[model samples]
Target: MKRTMLAVAGALLLGACATPSTEVGIALFNDTVQPLMVTGNTGTKVGRACAKNYLGLVITGDMSVEAAKKDGKITQVASVNKEVKGYALYAEVCTVVTGR
Candidate 1:
Protein backbone atom coordinates (compact mmCIF):
# COMPACT_ATOMS: atom_id res chain seq x y z
CA MET A 1 0.00 0.00 0.00
CA LYS A 2 2.82 2.45 0.83
CA ARG A 3 4.55 1.66 -2.46
CA THR A 4 1.39 2.32 -4.48
CA MET A 5 0.81 5.62 -2.67
CA LEU A 6 4.41 6.72 -3.24
CA ALA A 7 4.18 5.88 -6.94
CA VAL A 8 1.04 7.93 -7.38
CA ALA A 9 2.54 10.94 -5.64
CA GLY A 10 5.70 10.68 -7.67
CA ALA A 11 3.77 10.64 -10.94
CA LEU A 12 1.85 13.74 -9.96
CA LEU A 13 4.98 15.62 -8.96
CA LEU A 14 6.80 14.57 -12.15
CA GLY A 15 4.54 16.65 -14.39
CA ALA A 16 4.32 19.56 -11.95
CA CYS A 17 7.71 20.85 -13.03
CA ALA A 18 7.24 20.22 -16.77
CA THR A 19 7.69 23.16 -19.10
CA PRO A 20 4.68 24.96 -20.50
CA SER A 21 3.56 24.12 -24.04
CA THR A 22 2.22 26.38 -26.74
CA GLU A 23 0.46 23.74 -28.81
CA VAL A 24 -3.03 22.63 -28.00
CA GLY A 25 -2.12 19.03 -28.77
CA ILE A 26 0.43 16.82 -27.05
CA ALA A 27 3.90 17.26 -28.60
CA LEU A 28 7.46 17.34 -27.31
CA PHE A 29 8.41 20.32 -29.44
CA ASN A 30 5.45 22.57 -29.99
CA ASP A 31 5.11 25.81 -31.92
CA THR A 32 1.59 27.05 -32.34
CA VAL A 33 -0.36 30.23 -32.91
CA GLN A 34 -3.76 30.84 -31.43
CA PRO A 35 -6.19 33.69 -32.05
CA LEU A 36 -7.39 35.38 -28.90
CA MET A 37 -9.85 38.03 -30.03
CA VAL A 38 -11.03 40.10 -32.99
CA THR A 39 -12.87 43.37 -33.17
CA GLY A 40 -14.78 44.90 -36.09
CA ASN A 41 -11.60 46.47 -37.33
CA THR A 42 -8.17 44.93 -37.82
CA GLY A 43 -5.87 47.81 -37.06
CA THR A 44 -2.81 48.83 -39.03
CA LYS A 45 -0.32 48.63 -36.17
CA VAL A 46 1.10 45.34 -34.92
CA GLY A 47 3.18 44.47 -31.88
CA ARG A 48 4.35 41.41 -30.00
CA ALA A 49 5.46 40.89 -26.39
CA CYS A 50 7.06 37.69 -25.24
CA ALA A 51 7.84 35.90 -21.98
CA LYS A 52 10.27 33.03 -21.64
CA ASN A 53 10.70 30.04 -19.36
CA TYR A 54 13.98 28.34 -18.51
CA LEU A 55 13.97 24.68 -17.72
CA GLY A 56 10.52 25.17 -16.24
CA LEU A 57 12.29 26.81 -13.36
CA VAL A 58 12.49 30.51 -14.11
CA ILE A 59 9.94 32.47 -16.16
CA THR A 60 10.05 36.16 -16.95
CA GLY A 61 8.47 38.55 -19.42
CA ASP A 62 5.58 40.90 -20.09
CA MET A 63 3.41 38.79 -22.31
CA SER A 64 0.43 41.07 -22.11
CA VAL A 65 -1.76 42.80 -24.68
CA GLU A 66 -0.92 46.12 -23.08
CA ALA A 67 2.76 45.41 -23.62
CA ALA A 68 2.14 44.49 -27.22
CA LYS A 69 0.05 47.59 -27.72
CA LYS A 70 2.78 49.72 -26.24
CA ASP A 71 5.33 48.05 -28.48
CA GLY A 72 3.16 48.78 -31.52
CA LYS A 73 2.04 52.24 -30.34
CA ILE A 74 -1.58 51.27 -30.64
CA THR A 75 -4.58 53.24 -29.41
CA GLN A 76 -7.54 50.99 -29.94
CA VAL A 77 -7.36 47.24 -29.82
CA ALA A 78 -8.67 45.49 -32.94
CA SER A 79 -7.29 42.00 -32.54
CA VAL A 80 -5.14 39.83 -30.32
CA ASN A 81 -3.12 36.67 -30.81
CA LYS A 82 -1.01 34.27 -28.77
CA GLU A 83 2.02 32.36 -29.98
CA VAL A 84 3.91 29.62 -28.22
CA LYS A 85 7.14 27.78 -28.91
CA GLY A 86 8.19 25.16 -26.42
CA TYR A 87 11.12 22.78 -26.42
CA ALA A 88 10.84 20.65 -23.27
CA LEU A 89 13.66 22.57 -21.54
CA TYR A 90 12.74 26.10 -22.62
CA ALA A 91 9.63 27.90 -23.75
CA GLU A 92 8.58 31.19 -25.28
CA VAL A 93 5.10 32.62 -24.94
CA CYS A 94 4.08 35.76 -26.72
CA THR A 95 1.15 38.06 -27.10
CA VAL A 96 0.46 39.68 -30.47
CA VAL A 97 -1.72 42.76 -30.56
CA THR A 98 -3.07 44.88 -33.39
CA GLY A 99 -4.77 48.20 -33.17
CA ARG A 100 -4.98 51.71 -34.51
Candidate 2:
Protein backbone atom coordinates (compact mmCIF):
# COMPACT_ATOMS: atom_id res chain seq x y z
CA MET A 1 0.00 0.00 0.00
CA LYS A 2 2.81 2.39 0.87
CA ARG A 3 4.60 1.59 -2.36
CA THR A 4 1.46 2.18 -4.36
CA MET A 5 0.91 5.57 -2.75
CA LEU A 6 4.48 6.57 -3.49
CA ALA A 7 4.10 5.52 -7.09
CA VAL A 8 0.97 7.59 -7.49
CA ALA A 9 2.67 10.64 -6.03
CA GLY A 10 5.60 10.24 -8.39
CA ALA A 11 3.27 9.97 -11.35
CA LEU A 12 1.43 13.12 -10.34
CA LEU A 13 4.68 15.02 -9.97
CA LEU A 14 5.87 13.92 -13.38
CA GLY A 15 2.54 14.78 -14.93
CA ALA A 16 2.65 18.25 -13.50
CA CYS A 17 6.03 18.83 -15.06
CA ALA A 18 5.01 17.51 -18.44
CA THR A 19 4.60 20.40 -20.87
CA PRO A 20 2.18 20.07 -23.80
CA SER A 21 3.18 22.26 -26.71
CA THR A 22 1.43 23.40 -29.89
CA GLU A 23 1.93 25.76 -32.80
CA VAL A 24 -0.15 27.87 -35.16
CA GLY A 25 -1.21 25.67 -38.09
CA ILE A 26 -2.24 28.49 -40.40
CA ALA A 27 -0.27 31.20 -42.20
CA LEU A 28 -0.27 34.71 -40.75
CA PHE A 29 -0.44 36.73 -43.96
CA ASN A 30 -2.08 36.51 -47.40
CA ASP A 31 -0.64 39.53 -49.17
CA THR A 32 1.85 38.93 -52.00
CA VAL A 33 3.93 42.04 -51.49
CA GLN A 34 7.60 41.08 -51.20
CA PRO A 35 9.79 42.51 -48.47
CA LEU A 36 12.69 44.71 -49.43
CA MET A 37 14.89 42.97 -46.87
CA VAL A 38 14.13 39.51 -45.56
CA THR A 39 15.43 39.02 -42.07
CA GLY A 40 16.49 35.62 -40.83
CA ASN A 41 14.06 33.55 -38.85
CA THR A 42 14.19 33.84 -35.08
CA GLY A 43 12.62 32.18 -32.05
CA THR A 44 12.44 32.95 -28.35
CA LYS A 45 11.36 30.83 -25.41
CA VAL A 46 9.12 32.66 -22.94
CA GLY A 47 8.11 31.28 -19.58
CA ARG A 48 5.53 32.29 -16.95
CA ALA A 49 3.37 33.61 -19.78
CA CYS A 50 0.56 31.59 -18.33
CA ALA A 51 -0.22 29.46 -15.32
CA LYS A 52 -2.93 27.21 -13.91
CA ASN A 53 -3.80 26.77 -10.31
CA TYR A 54 -5.12 23.71 -8.50
CA LEU A 55 -8.61 25.07 -8.92
CA GLY A 56 -8.21 25.43 -12.71
CA LEU A 57 -7.78 29.21 -12.75
CA VAL A 58 -5.55 30.66 -15.45
CA ILE A 59 -3.43 33.81 -15.84
CA THR A 60 -1.53 35.18 -18.83
CA GLY A 61 1.02 37.86 -19.66
CA ASP A 62 2.69 39.63 -22.61
CA MET A 63 6.24 38.51 -21.94
CA SER A 64 6.21 36.17 -24.90
CA VAL A 65 5.17 38.87 -27.36
CA GLU A 66 7.79 41.33 -26.20
CA ALA A 67 10.50 38.69 -26.21
CA ALA A 68 9.65 37.56 -29.71
CA LYS A 69 9.71 41.06 -31.13
CA LYS A 70 13.02 41.81 -29.48
CA ASP A 71 14.63 38.61 -30.64
CA GLY A 72 13.44 39.05 -34.19
CA LYS A 73 14.42 42.74 -34.26
CA ILE A 74 11.16 43.46 -35.95
CA THR A 75 9.68 46.95 -36.18
CA GLN A 76 6.93 46.18 -38.63
CA VAL A 77 5.29 42.83 -38.22
CA ALA A 78 4.45 41.23 -41.55
CA SER A 79 3.73 37.72 -40.40
CA VAL A 80 3.72 35.73 -37.20
CA ASN A 81 3.69 32.13 -36.07
CA LYS A 82 3.06 31.11 -32.50
CA GLU A 83 3.93 27.98 -30.56
CA VAL A 84 2.56 27.30 -27.09
CA LYS A 85 3.86 24.91 -24.47
CA GLY A 86 1.66 24.27 -21.47
CA TYR A 87 2.22 22.50 -18.21
CA ALA A 88 -0.08 21.44 -15.43
CA LEU A 89 1.63 23.86 -13.03
CA TYR A 90 3.11 26.39 -15.44
CA ALA A 91 3.35 27.27 -19.12
CA GLU A 92 5.82 28.48 -21.73
CA VAL A 93 5.01 29.97 -25.12
CA CYS A 94 7.25 30.72 -28.07
CA THR A 95 6.71 33.14 -30.93
CA VAL A 96 8.36 32.80 -34.31
CA VAL A 97 8.43 36.09 -36.19
CA THR A 98 9.37 36.54 -39.81
CA GLY A 99 9.76 39.27 -42.45
CA ARG A 100 11.18 42.79 -42.42
* Strongest candidate by TM-score: 1
lDDT (0 to 1) per candidate: 0.81, 0.43
Candidate 1 stretches greater than 4 Å from native: 1-18
TM-score of each: 0.77, 0.39
Question: lDDT score of model 2?
Answer: 0.43
Q: Write the per-residue lDDT of candidate 2 for residues 1-100, one digit (tens) a residue.
A: 9999998887557545444333322121111222222335432432122222221234444535445566666555455554454444444444555534
Question: In model 2, which range of ten residues has the least summed lDDT?
Answer: 26-35
TM-score of 2: 0.39
lDDT of 1 by residue, 5-97 (tens): 998776444434444644466454678889999999869999999998775678899999989999999999999999988775677889999
Candidate 2 off by > 4 Å: 1-5, 13-63, 85-92
Note the clash tally of each candidate. Answer: 0, 0
